[model samples]
Target chain A: MTDATATRPSIAGEQRIDGSDLLGDVEFLVARVRAIGSGHAREALAPFGLRVRAYAVLSLACGSVSPTQRDIADFLQLDPSQVVAVIDSLEASGFVRRAQHPRDRRVNIVEATEQGLATYAEAREAVSRARDRSLGSLSAEERETLTSLLLKVAF
Target chain B: MTDATATRPSIAGEQRIDGSDLLGDVEFLVARVRAIGSGHAREALAPFGLRVRAYAVLSLACGSVSPTQRDIADFLQLDPSQVVAVIDSLEASGFVRRAQHPRDRRVNIVEATEQGLATYAEAREAVSRARDRSLGSLSAEERETLTSLLLKVAF
Candidate 1:
């Protein structure tokens, strides 16, 4: 009704709700992009039997981060339970080994086994390709700009 | 291992897995931002008893687009099943009603009820607040640049 439109924000003729523009909304855009990229990354890594999240965990372990499960969870903004589940699967597959932190034995440090490191080497290639595809139409310069801006914002 | 380092990409001396840097990778950055923003959004909408995804779906309904569930899924890049589940819940909550598309009776078009529109107004404010909080350190101009760049790449 005219009264309703008069009371709240309106956009582009009609079909807008409460002034929020989903299409223009950066948050919504980021979410959709993540969903699309995450799906692509998962499919790319499927042959390795690794989901994107698992690959992320494996990547962290194969690095010098030497993160505890808790640290990984915090960095990735994942629930501890979710990080635990991935770690469980990785450990079961013998891709990684979890040991007590030498400095803090109460928390386990997850490290990639030799086999895990090898798989990540290949998986990294696939993930890199996925990254290229996800960046889509952006030029190399735009990609760098996007990455640099996002790093400053999200990190 | 020296052998491994010689064969593949390397980063920052130790424990680096291949050459990929998660920090610099735009895809991972995007995914993390999405996760962080999604979490904040969900918590903000929790008082309205709506998840971010559900609120997104509802926002679409309240608009003039008069979208079918399939259209919603396509726009949101969600699975058909996920879209269906949200429509079902929104319908049950008396927030939306599903009616056959006037031109294509086989598919249902979702529209918001008066109550749905009212709820969306409040929920939208919360989501807006979350958006502000998520973009924490970015300047107004930077937000514009980030949004503008993401629009070109994603849309």
Candidate 2:
């Protein structure tokens, strides 16, 4: 079945009949690209038994510092309950564990296990490949520019 | 309560300890900024009884072309069922209506009601202001660059 081609803008300026109005909107563009990228990452990480969110948690855990659940929630912009759930799943898979903070006994820090690091190494490669494929249209310079611009808004 | 400072990078060059590793990852940055921007839009759009996704739908509906349900789904990268649900809500709220396509009887096009267009105009202003607030850190030129880069990836 033929889909609606009415929405596609023509170069000749022949009375545009489409949702091209949304094309210039930053939020819409961001959400669209993110959804597409996330879908690709999810598919790529599926063989590793990891979703994008879980992979994000694992990636953060592989960082230099052992992040607490609260830190994960804040950095990932996830709810505390959601962070707890991802951590719980990661712990069950032996990817991460909650331990008492080195300086603060009252708090728990999430640290990656050896297996977790190894798994992350593989998953990171897969995720990177997936990202590269998703952003294959852009040049290296464009990608770098995109990243730098995103950081200004993101952080 | 003192949150875990472990994840915060030290400024003294004493070995940066944080998820700085994921900072360069485009997908992560996109997700982060999108989350922050969406949150701001959500709050600003609340008074109009719209969320980001719904606002997107309404914005599309307000465009020059009356988009079909399939068109909306394809353009938004949303599930057809989800589009149907959103359309149902908007239709019930008198914001939009499903009409038989002038060119194709079998196709139903989604068009904004007068109320929908009026509401959309106000919501667009709110959403734009919210986006400006969320992206306050960037210069106007940077915002344009960000939007252009996002469009390249999104389209």
- Name the best candidate (by lDDT): 2
Please tell me the TM-score of chain B in candidate 1 relative to the true structure's chain B.
0.84
- Collision count for each candidate, in order: 4, 0
Residues B31-135, model 1: lDDT tens digits: 888877888898999999898889989988877676767667767878899998998899888899988655445677788999999999999889999988999
Q: After superposition, how far is residue A87 of candidate 1 from its true place, in Å?
A: 1.8
A94: Cα error in model 1, Å: 2.6
Q: TM-score of each model's B chain?
A: 0.84, 0.88
Q: Model 2: runs farther than 4 Å from truth?
A: A1-17, B1-17
Model 1 C-alpha lDDT per residue in residues A1-155, reported as the tens digit of each score: 75554432222343433323787688888987777788789889999999888888898888766667766787788899999899999999898988876545567778899999999999989988988887878889888888888887786
Looking at model 1 chain A, which ten-residue stretch has the lowest summed lDDT?
Answer: A7-16
lDDT of 2 at B99: 85
